[model samples]
Target chain A: MSLSTVAGARLVARKDLRIEQHSRVALAQMLPFGMLVLILFAFALDPSRDVLTRATAGLFWMTVLFTSTLAVQRAFAVEVDDGALDSIRLSGISAASVFLGKVSALVIQLLVLEAVLALGVAILYNTDFGGWAMLVAVTLLSTIGMSAAGATYGVLVSRLRHSSTLLPLLLLPLLAPVLIAATKGSEVALGQEAGQSWSWVALLAVFAISYLVLGVVLYRPLLEET
Target chain B: MTTTFAPKIIGTSSPATRILGVLSIIGLIALVVFGLVISPADFELGETIRILYMHVPTVSVAYLAFIITGVGSVIYLWKRSEFWDLLAASAAEIGVLFFGLTIFNGMMWGKITWGVFWRWEPRLVTTTVLFITYIGYLVVRSIPTDTRTRGTVSAVIGIMAIVNIPITHKAVDWWRGLHQSSTIFATVDPDMRGTQLFSAYLGLTVFLVIFAWLLIHRFRVAWLSERARGIGLDEAIAARRAEGSFS
Candidate 1:
């Protein structure tokens, strides 16, 4: 019997999970990497509590942005190899669904990284951890937006020559608005009362949705042409 | 036989070309003389601001060329005509020239005004991005064969990046308005007694004519190059066919 939408997505997600089992490619070294970033941030920034307090949110988001790029860049590499991407397309599954699965997997990876990084920053920099819920929400939304934009640019340019360099150039500019909004959102969650933190969160939500839709719609044509 | 198309600014050897060439030359002479000798020094930046007569119009012309490239890109995608593709490529090639000039002039103005040649200010950053995007367009084209796919992709990206032009112009407004954003292109009042303004318009007209002349020449060059390659391929194929027939 054919699978329902939910069933199909779950099945595809499981297949990816199974593939990841042996390789353990996804989320590999994420915790340690996030720790490395936090340690680096400590050494780079002044040791003053005042400085750390102000720079924590920016530092956290920057870490996420860079780490997430590393994560998303590999999101499709496996499927692209061994002709699995073509097979997936031929599998009568929605590209959007597959995109969602990849994004979901990435979200899981990012959430883990963020949790560890935020905890480390909190313990080290004396962050209050008062807005943990808001931190989680912003992390989720921001990751979705970045991953969607990154994945779209990734798929579009992957077949091109020098795509590794091209992807960052194209993706970074598109990701700028997201990065700005999300960092502000995190600042709000951290109880740094710059007015309109919620507004920034709202903007992140809107951006996430826009990039999601753009990725889903553009994926079909982009993949077909490739 | 291969026919090479050379880009002409005002005219070829034709009489009409000679007439337009003469007119453009006279217009340029009058504009330059009026601008340098007749235009008054500015109240604020003084003599340095005189560069605006040349700088502003060149940037505007470059923007005009890019806008046309965007239009040509859209037309190519819609019509799937090589003509439109050639047109877009030509505009981009020439657009880069004018854009480079604009950036150069901007640096000169920046040095004189801000006392620095480069800054990460919104306007400057956006202009740099625009320059990079055009250079990317040219690089995308210059890659080895497979013009069909690469050309279409470049065209789509070109049209989409037009979204950047307005955004760049408005970056200051949207984020931080800087360096006197113009509300209207016609903001110059009749009170302005600088002959440079009038002379600038004359320069604009001459440049527009040059743009058209170059477009015609570029289109012909691309078409002939394609034809010359096709002829070379055809002769090789015919020679092979004759050999096969004898064998």
Candidate 2:
């Protein structure tokens, strides 16, 4: 809440954006990769056209989960690779602020990726968007929760030698609840006949806010750790 | 002859310690014999409820270990004590062991009860995930070269992973799970019998006692190893300083 904290967060966000802008490779790599996954799912499942209607929400969320993993890891990869971590810590800024800034940037990157994937699902599988507005709400909620928890764990575990292998192991299990709620929420928003799936949407919202608060508070100790 | 501060054994080995040991032994005996014999045959499950003797207790104990780990983590972080960190890590490692048994026993049970070895049942799925996360914690522990770093990082992870459990517990309510409902503990009904209820408590108490004993031993070992490693480092540094002074 301090001015310095806000400034620190802004500075960290700007720094990440600048890094992404320069290489732009991280952004470029995921789209084709994500599309390929979608292609594989389509070929593999071979669901009936009627089946696609019911399956769209699951398929859409699956795409987001995998693609977001790819996109999210890169958020910290660059900073860690260049030893910017130590410098950031030494800059007299709060670590929690840095975590907020990193999570914010991740949300932006994930939103972009999810947007593309959502469109892909819509075109490929005829995903209904009747209550599309709620879909967006669920998407945002799930994205924030996933990124906040993922980024916190990713940052803490990044220093491990086998982190690339371990990150998902640590992340996906925890992310399952978020995935379930979000998928169900999106289903309801898609106007599929389901009984009171709005409960899931509420859960997603609660989950996101909880993670946001928790990640901010817990980030300091983990940041100081590395 | 380990010079490490093991859990203190008061004037007469401590009443809590004696009681815990006796209870653990008796419970293990009951689990092996009484759980197999005295518990009535399930109308549906038959002899396989015998498997529940092991399978059910393993899952119950694993959960108990994790809860203790969570508590230990909170204490470790707050007090900044090596004792609490060691306790947490020991509990986590043992929890990992028990959780693995839980999954293993559950899979075998599932193969019989559910006609398949694995399904996306919320109970099994969540527990499996928790087990895997426990292994991930070990990986986290393996990464940090220093004791303090390892302990502290693992503590943070232990705490975070605990946050995942409530969701895991509620997975049955949230998803289309293949697992049966919690008969005894569900909001809709409580179906445990007098013996069944007694057995559950007996199992929990036994596991807690075993966990305490293991924690004390594991913490002692960890403390000693850390001390030994510290000595080695100090000697190496001293040798380097001597070389510098001679030069």
Candidate 1 per-residue lDDT over residues A5-124, each given as its tens digit:
556656666776666666766447656777788778878888788888887888888788777777766666676767787887788877777666666667766777787788888888
lDDT of 1 by residue, B123-171 (tens): 5565666777778677666655455676566675566456445533443
**Per-prediction backbone clash count:** 2, 0
Q: How high is the DockQ of candidate 2? A: 0.57
- Report the poorest 10 consecutive residues by lDDT, candidate 2 chain A: A193-202
Considering the true interface contacts (CA pairs under 8 Å between chains A and B), give the fraction that model 2 also has.
0.48
Across B40-105, the per-residue lDDT of candidate 2 in tens digits comes to 665555666556656665676677778877888778767778888777777788888888877777
Q: lDDT score, residue A88, model 1?
A: 76
Give DockQ for candidates 1 onward, in order: 0.22, 0.57
